[model samples]
Target: MKRLTITTLLAVALLSGCSSKEEVIPDVPPSNLYATAQTALQSGNWTSAIEQLEALDSRYPFGAYSDQVQLDLIYAYYKSDDLALGEATIERFLRLNPDHPQADWVVYMRGLTHMAQDRSFMHDMFNINRFDRDPTPSRQAFTDFKYLLERYPESEYGADAKARMIFLKNRLANYDLATADFYVRREAWIAAINRCQQVQRLYPDTEAARESLKLEKTAYEKLNLQKEVERTEKMMKLNPAK
Candidate 1:
């Protein structure tokens, strides 16, 4: 009787372990997982799409849809407003598949992610100046877009990237102008002059160029650099709208 009880207990333990193991692991096929993720993406359910894609990636890292899954994951993360994750995923994709046919799309999406993050609630809703806040993200976006234009000028997205680059350049110039204005207000003549000079040299055709020239003139006058003041005044006259 004792031997029979011990045997029954061992059988029960083995059955319990097997049941727990099966319950813990899902038996999803790779194709089904990819299809489910695609469906979620098509339905605009970005969060669900991410979850499914992530599952597929973990289970079948080298599956037929692995590359496509990574690409879709980037879009899903971006759509879900997970900007940091989206950016990281794109960088990974670029690093791994630099010559991928869709490289231009990846680069463009990365630039868009930065641009989207640069816009804040205050800037969008209250019409607050973006230059009043941090400009790092905007600068980064501008760099990304410029790189895309330089590397893939004939890309399908080249025109849009170029347009965004122009907008970002203007914004960056305005940011420098704002800094110059602040320095002028604080009577930091040299710093003000430097900021204005950056705007004039780097963003000559931008609207900020006019304000930059005006600021530079004021700074030069404050520093008693009469020659510089005259030169700036002459330049400003030559380009009245500058």
Candidate 2:
């Protein structure tokens, strides 16, 4: 019985010593954290993955794995609903690793962020949607999508981006006309004319411009503006097909 008791006490002492050592040691290695983070990502545990990957910030500063970890960290921030951080990280990554094979993916992801946040003009006036006043996001989305279309037309997402570009073009043209119509209704003839002219300059091919021209002619006629109306009519005659 005494021998058994000694054995038990020794086993307990050894376990206690090992636990103390583990408590004092930083148990996670950079590689292990990265691997675990990847596994968590694959399982769709984005929050957990971000937590693990972010812990490797100051450690493992010079390895190939470190570069990959940073890339994955950007994705984790995006997937975990931390878009601001994700965008900043992506920009930094692009600047640091412009030649990286996956750089295109980062650009595309940024474009997607812009597209997803885009809003129409009536969003606030009609309580339609969020981000109504900012055409900046939509414009950036269009620019990026156009870049992909012109340069990487055969990319997997290129076709979809092109379709989105078409939709955005029409939507933006409509927005211009809507602004002109608003000014017209408010009897702001100069603003209305300027906006109509802007639509023609920016989106001459759209139906919105066609509609805007007709409305502009009416606005000029209402103000008894003979010269401007005559000029507009002469232009329409020159381009009869439009």
Top-scoring candidate (lDDT): 1
Error of 2 at 111 (Å): 0.7
Error of 2 at 64 (Å): 2.7
Report the C-alpha lDDT of model 1 over 93-211, residue by residue, as the tens digit: 99999999999999999999999888876678998776856778889998988889898888999999989989989888889999999999999999999888898899988889887
Error of 1 at 121 (Å): 3.1
Which residue pairs show backbone clashes in model 2? none
The runs of at least 3 residues in candidate 2 whose Cα sits more than 4 Å from the true structure, single-residue gaps closed, are 1-27, 119-132, 151-154, 226-242
Cα lDDT of candidate 2 equals: 0.76
Candidate 1's TM-score reads 0.85
Error of 1 at 124 (Å): 2.7
lDDT by residue for model 2 (48-129), tens: 7877776666566676577777788777876665767777887888888887877767777777767655643466468773
For TM-score, the strongest prediction is 1
